[model samples]
Target: MKERVRAVLVTADDTMLVIRRTKPCIPEYWVLPGGGVEPGDESREAALHREIHEEIAGKAHIIRLLHTMESEDERQLFYLARIATWSFEDRTGPEFSAEGRGEYMLEEIPLTVEALDGINLKPDEIAHVLRGTMEAGALGDGAAA
Candidate 1:
């Protein structure tokens, strides 16, 4: 099975950082900053840290594991985290240089439900989870899950 890690990266201004993907013949969508867990990674959290750095050129303090999605051949872990800084222009993820992988634009959107609804956030499940959590006042509390 394959494992992936992603972060619900929240900023000091109560906005979430996501990547906007644009490709030919496909509708635009947003995604959390993350990637597949590598075999060399010491742990899932370590992979998350590395991915956050590679994808956004940022360091994140992970608060806690927020959600998990599993299928027959893949599993994804989502963590809630706080990021104080990032340099999108400095991102070094290999995917950016790969041909035909599409364009990736780093974007910060409000953490509000309205913002989440306005874009097609992939994996549908994560967006739904966030919406429910936000509605119940269980998220965006700052530095803690």
Candidate 2:
């Protein structure tokens, strides 16, 4: 089985950081920043931090484990986190140089339900969870702090 970690990264101004992926012959979609958990990673949170740095050249303070999804061969852990800054231009992820991996554009969108609805965020279950949480105000103003 494979394990992955991702961050629902919130910025100071209440926006969420996502990566817009564009592939040949496929519609563009957005995804949270993250990747597979490597054996060298000390923990899941550490893997998230490492992945954020690799994918966006950013550092994040993870607040909590927001959600988890599992399939027969893979499990993905999503963390709620706060990020103060990132430099997409400085990203060093190997995927960027890989062939046929598609385009990865860093974008920040409003952390509102309407904003979530407008994008084809991958892993529909996580999108639905975000909508429900945002509606209940469970994330709150300080969620990004």
Each candidate's lDDT (Cα)? 0.93, 0.92
Tens-digit per-residue lDDT, 35-141, candidate 2: 99999999989999999999999999889898999999999999999999999999999999999998999999998999999999989999988889999887655
Q: Where does candidate 2 have its weakest 10-residue lDDT segment? A: 136-145
Residue 130 error, candidate 1, Å: 0.4
TM-score of each: 0.97, 0.97
Which candidate tops lDDT? 1
Q: Note the clash tally of each candidate.
A: 0, 0
Q: What is the lDDT of residue 21 in candidate 1?
A: 97
Q: Alpha-carbon error at 126 in model 2, in Å? A: 0.5
Could you tell me how far off, in angstroms, the CA of residue 102 lies in candidate 1 after the best superposition?
A: 0.7
Positional deviation of 144 in candidate 2, in angstroms?
4.6
